[model samples]
Target chain A: MTRLTRSAALGAVGMLAASAPAFAQSIDEKVNEAFANSTGWFVSFIFSPFPGTTFPWIVMWLVVAATVFTLYFGFVQFRTFGHAIRLVRGDYSDPNDAGEVSHFQALATALSGTVGLGNIAGVAVAVGIGGPGATFWMILAGLLGMASKFTECTLGVKYRNEYADGTVSGGPMYYMTKGFAERGLPGGRFLAILFSIFCILGALGGGNMFQANQAHAQLTNVVGDYPGWITGVIFAGIVFAVIVGGLKSIAKVTEKVVPIMGVMYVATAVVILIMNADMIGWAFGQIFAGAFTGLGVAGGMVGALIQGFKRAAFSNEAGVGSAAIAHSAVRTKEPITEGFVSLLEPFIDTVVICTMTALVIIITQQLIIDETTGLYMLNEAGTAIATVDGNSGVALTSAAFSSAFGWFQYVLALAVILFAFSTMISWSYYGLKAWTYLFGEGKTTELVFKVIFCIFVVIGAAASLGPVIDFSDAAIFAMAVVNIFALYFLMPIVRGELGSYLDRLQSGKIKKYN
Target chain B: MPSKIVVGFDGSESAKRALDFAVAQAKAKGAGIVIAHVLEWSPYSFLTPTELEERHKRRGEELARAETALLKPVVDSLKDSGVEVSTALKYGHIAETLASVTKAESASQIVIGRTGHSSLSSRLFGSVAGSLAQAAPVPVTIVP
Candidate 1:
């Protein structure tokens, strides 16, 4: 990690010095020039992110999938919400139960991993780029995400592997392979292999590399250049120290840190809104108008919906199956307990935090891009300023907060660094777990992957890996494609587990422990 | 000449019982004893190098002081019963560290607190004991 980080620092400095001439030219002129002469293959128009065809198809499928699964499961997520709360309280915990952390701690740990960056940075991006209607789609996406979380996490527990020494290892691999094998499905192994491959890919790029890159970027942006490799090396060192200690250490740290961060973040958002209380109504109006009216700056109503849904999907990551990896490590014998807790993730990440970010941006009147010459100039405090290196939206968000609260950029920077770092650390574990599952576990094998992961963090920070990020994002979402498909077949198993677990709850078998 | 057993206690009723089980087992088998409790420090990664070491030193001293108080009762009882006992206090990843100390001390087993998780609430949210038991590389006996 250290060696790779040093290399990254050298590379970034070289790039910065080389690009100094470009920096002095002013971002607006550069964006203007780029947009003026921009030309692409005509077929690219179909994928151009206009509202009608591109947006509706994806969102409609998601909504339909969410609706059907919700109806089929009989709104199990809602019915079991209270039960989830109790489970986290350890109301039914047995000291003798074999697991890593308390139910609450497990939820906290998983939340720490899921709830960051996505809520703050991802939400801002969605609304900033997608417009107000994006909020609606984000909410819709979150609603459907619950069903996905329920199905995947239930399987995570059910298909877990109990080692000879009594240690348990479980995830989609266990369920896809073992569950299918039980059903006499000959292709179970192949499907499971495919799922593991997807998980490893998603984990490394979206989970590990993206996270590390973002964290490094934020730290450098805030603290300025550290020995180039210093950020990556130090971050990797922290990850190694905790991961070597295994899940228990991760759980403990997450349990403590997640809550503090959540509170601080939410409170900041609320305070921002309270001060701008009058704009609350206008913001919601814009959100609804943009969502249904389709008169957004980018594309029409349809475009708004697509952007919103995509951002929400990107932020909450409900159906992606990444959260399931973290949630799978929960200690309960009942898979349903964690499933219920899993539902809360999207709510917190998308519904609450994302909404707050949208409100902050909209209430501040910063959502729209002012058109100057064929290029769109991002408005910061009524001035048309273009982003250096083309970072318009979320960085604009930081500027908005800085406008409102002096030194607020520093706060945002710190938050991003923490959020990015935590997300990267958690994703590293998730990716590594999937890696080990596919290929066998050993210290030497782990060391090799860890180095690669650390290297990607620097790459992510140093260069604009546009195609790579896009491909990785697609892969992350693509997990939903295979995952939701398998989920339809496995719904019954989840139903059965839910029934048995609920029956025990109703019978008072679990109440005595609390 | 049986090996000492390590048990973790966090002042819960179940933890007390787990402590009892470890002490009793160690006494019965004529082995030594190690009692451990993990103090969770927040945001240690963000701390400066000097601050981190200082906090570590402070925690070590605190552990040393707490160790005598926590183990005195068990040690007195075990000595009276002609059983040799030793206690240790460590920080960070209690389960893995316990597993390491279990092997280090050549202890035969580990006794851990298992608050009842079969209740209604546990069915909905979950419990940590099962994961700990599953992840630990030693035989773990959970005391409810």
Candidate 2:
């Protein structure tokens, strides 16, 4: 084992040396230009007009759907929040149940997928662009998103297909088709296919590619700039190994890594918050004040609202339907219990973790407001820039941590790699599932999809931020569009399931072993 | 119907010693031996639906493999020695599930191996034998 590892390390170094000339050729710029040119139309269409404003309608699609679900479920996310905790603790789980994993495992797997670069980098971007007020809206969106998570995951379990072998397949595709057919609704098959197609694209773009892109960014920032392709190749190789073992291997890694990384990152943020204890009150004040008054951002209240909702949607991914895939595998006879357990995901990913990142940035005084112009000091591209690193997004987040502890950038870099790795492996499963759903399941087809996924990791790393973020946002939002529509149609089924489950519980019919 | 002696078996050398001890106890007391293999499983690890399905399948394969390669040969040999024997394969927390199985089978005594893992590692990860000694519904004998 030692010899094999040494040889592998040597080979990697040799490859890096061989690729040295390619690094100087500006391959990332070319890839960025090519991606932007090819995908510009699709990207713009999905992120279409609020005319005279930068707000994309896709953001509204997710936010509005989340709000509607929250209201429609009579605030089920809040009402069942305690039950969700108990369910995750295995109080309600029967070991004899048919599903594959426990509720906690399902939640952890889903959380690992959602709680990646978005929490660190995306929050920084939101706060940078929309100012402190964006934090408030982001929190609200996360709260609303819980309802969306509840709605979809219930359907994920309710309408799931259990094969003769006892393995299950589900998500928007199954729910859309199966639930719609049960409801005597038309276009069930068509909508299922549409959702599956979007899921495949979204998994590749947002889940796999964007994670690799951000990880490469953080890596280069710490280790000094190299051709992103080098990071990409190394990342792709590692990701390929994990993902090729399939979901079990990925889950094993994510379950252990996600919780540790999350706690480590949040603990660091907490330490920073405590160290800047005097500024926390002032930070909250700015958040609340800027939320209402817009502070000094470009579009005022609207800009903050847009950035907050957009970033929150991107972060928690409540309406995006990917969590449904992970949640469906949980071992539970009561599908509604899984829904209750799943609602905690968005709260953890967005409301808790993302808030920590935002608080750290705010408490560190990362974003500077221009008092005279009533606007943020803009960079050449007109976006708000962080003063500490002269960079934004994840770099700004790194700077925030480094401000409190000088050596934290290295730690943050490690966290970013873990986050990126976990995200890629999870997304690889999501994409492969979608791929198999479309192309029919076989070893060859599965390998084909995995190979394509790994290649994109390199492409994503070798591309500039503009095209990568744009494409990711577009693909992910497109998935939300399809998934939310299916949810709207299928929520009555979820409502019924939740009502029945609650009745059994209230009547003391559902046995609790723990 | 003879009183039952439950033995935790994993096909390890220590487990072979444990089985021999259980056989002697069963022979002296004229009891039937129930050999149990409990696969340690965590309820906290994240898994995708596909992976979950694969795990469920792998679990089945593991049970079958244990039956064919370990339990069957041991059971046949014990039966040849004029001792009635049965085997069980289950998935859960090792000690707790073994205790549950003991109670369900009406087994009067339990036997397990002192796990080969180092003391430090066992302390870190929790030793099944130590836990079974404390928590088993019946008296447990540990064969080192």
Candidate 3:
């Protein structure tokens, strides 16, 4: 059986590679054009500006929700951060608790979904457009976003459906519906359905396509440009195999992949930062100065804040309510413990990892700031920019790292691909949960969604960035729009859960076996 | 009506030794012997609904296999013996499950093998025998 499985896997890879060239350039262009045209209207509307202001209202929707949750919880994210670490360490877990995965495994699985290309490429984009000051706002946003995660995840576990078979299904869909019912609130069902719809779309767009798209870009940057469909086919096959094997397979892979990729990426960044240790102080000064004074970048302080907040939301996904789905699976009778553990996701993904990427870019002097004007140099299109081989995003990050070590681009490429792969695997699960919730749970329904999701891997790879980014942003932000509403109503429940858990913990009623 | 002694059995050499020790103790005390085999099964958070469903089916199969293939033969051979013998199969943390089975059976003491599979993991996390010694409700005897 092992030999047969191995051969089958090898055959799939061989078939993918053998069929690559058949995907013509014209077809790629057509797919890209079709996506751009079809998705433009919805994308523009979802990201439409607030009345008489340039700011995207969806971004503000997330920011305001995060800030409010932060204050409402009395900064639970900070106060419980240590306890959260202990929970993940299985210190507070009862071996007899009726749940599927361990706290650490759930945290790892959720982290895999969030800590992807956003850390590598998105940070560069934020730094590019918003300038170094964007890093400041990004960190701030990540800190506030932790509170949002804590609230949604606590409610997620509180209202989760535990089956007789010991399986669990939870997320915004369950919490929004069941939680609202418990509170005697109307429209719980409607809100849940809305959240599910957005989650499914978000899974397809941000989770699958955006990852496939970025992975393709990174691969092409390392190797010569090949058709995106080739990358898509290979990724689709691997992803399908893991997802079909179900959550255990996905978790097993992510548990290993997330740690390795995170360590490798962070370690490389640390080495680079230390190599240029002399400039570390200067980089912080630049970030702080640019944050307030705009550093002469286009749009200045406001632009930096918007980009920082947007990308931080995109990267950590705290308010989007997806991580709650992952965290809810942890084995704990005390629902608030999972929430506490989940607050660490944004801190690790955005504050630590994203900041590392941003610092590397700033310290390396990659943004080409004009000394006299105190402004970032503009590209041919009149946009503030940084580039290597006319490549930006992950490529720009690659360039920054490669400056310290010439061979670093190769490592960055591999890390990007792994990050992309792990993210896709995790998102597939998140998307599947949402899919099952909406379509109803059955083998045929699940297979249909899984097949469609795999097909989107191809579409994501083949499609151009314009539509992919638009769709990803719209779907994710739409989830926040629905989720934050439920959170506003449900914060009291989370607060209660937190208060009781903390009281028990303080009173020494909650025993720590480990 | 006689006292019962629980023996942790897994069909390994050391487990056979532990079983022999339990039998000797039972014979001396005029007690009965309950053979208990625990399959280490920890819940994973990463399983999907479908996988979880499938896992439950697999768990049943595993328990059945352990009963028929491992425990039944031993129980059958001991059936004719004068000392009373029974069997149990459970899925969970080995030491805790054994301790629970001992408590359930009202057994006076528990006997287990010093596991041969000691590695870095055992050193870091401690072995089942070591944990059993600490957490087991009854006195535990480790047969080397």
Candidate 4:
């Protein structure tokens, strides 16, 4: 083991030496470009209407809405966590559950969807822009996200449709179409159709394209460019093959992949912490300082708080209603069961993994200056420079990890590939679920959507998709706008179901084993 | 004889179940059982050396108390098993710490309780048990 680790280290050092001159040249040019861009565009474009920024507006509203929804629903995220746990545990196993997968499977599937790039790149961006104080708000956002998940998942279960052959179809489309129809609300079908369109777009852009784009970038960055489109083709093929099996294959794969990857990633971060045990305190100190002191881009502490909250909400995606599409497919009679399992999504993705990424960044002394332009990038870099908040992509995290662990860049590159791949596959299903809901559940229609989704994998890799990613990400936040609104109206139903489940729990009627 | 097993205890629900299951197996097989837990040094190393040492000491004591509380129930359960039973608490890398504990005690098997849905996580790339099984030099039983 010692020999292997030593050899690995030596190989990395050799690679660093071989690549230094070329890497250094690119780095120097990038720094100059970054500084010039930041001076030219950042102040005028990003910092001026900082408060009125769409990222902030959408994020703040979602946080406020999620929090309000939680309070109005009497903190359903908490009251139902135990029930959700039981649901996953199969304590009240109802084989007759209309959903296509088990409650646990549903949670795992949703987790596979929710737990990818956002936990990694998204959190890195959050802490990078908002500073360490953002960690606190991110956690807060994750807690509130539970209520959002509960509301969406319950509505998914409540409004789900089963064909004569027992195939299931649900999500915002069904909930808005059937749910609002029952409520005598106007414009349910139109909004549902709009959401379906958005879901399809989201699956392709944020889910498939974004995941592929980042993964391709990381792999090319670390391994050097391997015909970039090669990754897309291969990735698309693998995902296409699995998704063809529908939710069953996706669930089977996710149930296994989600936990394993989740634990491994956390363990890797733990190892990094253990290796750099000395730097933990300094990391926290910097985090607190950056968060409160404010990097001084958009004004004072309030701007920093907004940045932090926005980044966390973006990272964990707790209230976005996307995860609900996945959760709606859980095979259980109880809606709250899947809801409970869904709560772990944010805890694992944001609180645990995001914190780890933040720690890696904080522990290592990497500043968020542009590698290309050498200037300090601002929060709105995505729209301004067609990148996220004017910063680099997953390289920020790779750079941070590399600063401490040396060869960590390679490992992180692999992680990015897996993270992106898994996220893309999961998001494809989310889009497909929404797709099937809008269109009838015909096999050929499903194939058409899958093909388009797969093709985006190639386009996502070949194209410089920063602007598109920003737009899709905006759409993700926008989805929260409507879904959280729906959650407010449907929160009563969630509470009632949660109460009944908790009642069973308190009565000890649900045994540990059958 | 059934395989001798070693388990870790930290008072977590999963840990307690692992200990319980480990004890029952030890009783059933008349094999040796060792329960262990780890006390990690808090990452707050920014304080003065004295203060940091004091914090570590306090945390160690607290962890010791917690582990003892967790082990007491398992110890009583194995009283009639005729299986050699011992408890250990150490500070370090969890996988390495557990592996060393397994070896030092001459135990042949390691038992760990899986977090909810953790066992099913084999399809994902980086599970704890799966990782441990790949890296560990011994057999591991994950009680789900």
Candidate topping lDDT: 3
Which of 1 and 3 is ahead in TM-score?
3
What TM value does the first chain of each candidate achieve?
Answer: 0.81, 0.94, 0.94, 0.79
The digit string of per-residue lDDT tens for model 4 on B1-144 reads 445688966667887788778777877777778887755431211121112113324444565575667667767776776778788776544566678778777778888877766454356646556666766667888887
User: Which should have the higher TM-score, number 1 or number 4?
Assistant: 1
Candidate 3 segments whose C-alpha is farther than 4 A from its true place: A1-23, A97-100, A245-251, B1-8, B25-144
Tens-place lDDT per residue, model 4, A1-514, is 1336634643564465455656643543453344344334322332233365534456667778778768877877776666566666666663222112445556655666667777777766666656655666677777777667667877886777655534455677778777777767787787777777767777777787778878877866765644435556666766776666443444344445556766777787788788889988877765566567654434345555766676667666666777766666555556666667777777666767778877876566555445684333454543211123234557777777766678877767766776676677667777877787777668899899989998878766655544545645755665666666666666677778777877887888655443
Number of the candidate with higher lDDT, 2 or 3? 3
Q: CAPRI verdict on model 1?
A: incorrect
Candidate 2 differs from the real structure by a C-alpha RMSD in angstroms, to one decimal, of 2.9
Over A1-514, each residue of candidate 1 has an lDDT whose tens digit, in order, gives 3437745764665565455635522432443233223322211331344364455344455556667777888887678777777776667766334223455655555666677666766666666556667788788778777777777888877777755543456667777788877766676667667777777667666675556555655665665544323454555655655555343444344445556767876787788899999888877877787678654345556656766777677676666666666666555667778888788777777778888877877677664444543223443442222333334444656765665786777777767766666676666676776678778888888877777776655444443323334544655655666666677777788888878877887887755564
Categorize the docking of model 2.
acceptable
Quote the B-chain TM-score, candidate 1: 0.70
Give the DockQ-based CAPRI class for model 4. incorrect
Evaluated against the true structure, the overall lDDT of model 2 is 0.83
TM-score of each: 0.69, 0.93, 0.86, 0.65
Q: What is the lDDT of residue A214 in candidate 4?
A: 82
lDDT (0 to 1) per candidate: 0.63, 0.83, 0.84, 0.65
Model 3 alpha-carbon miss at residue A125, Å: 1.7
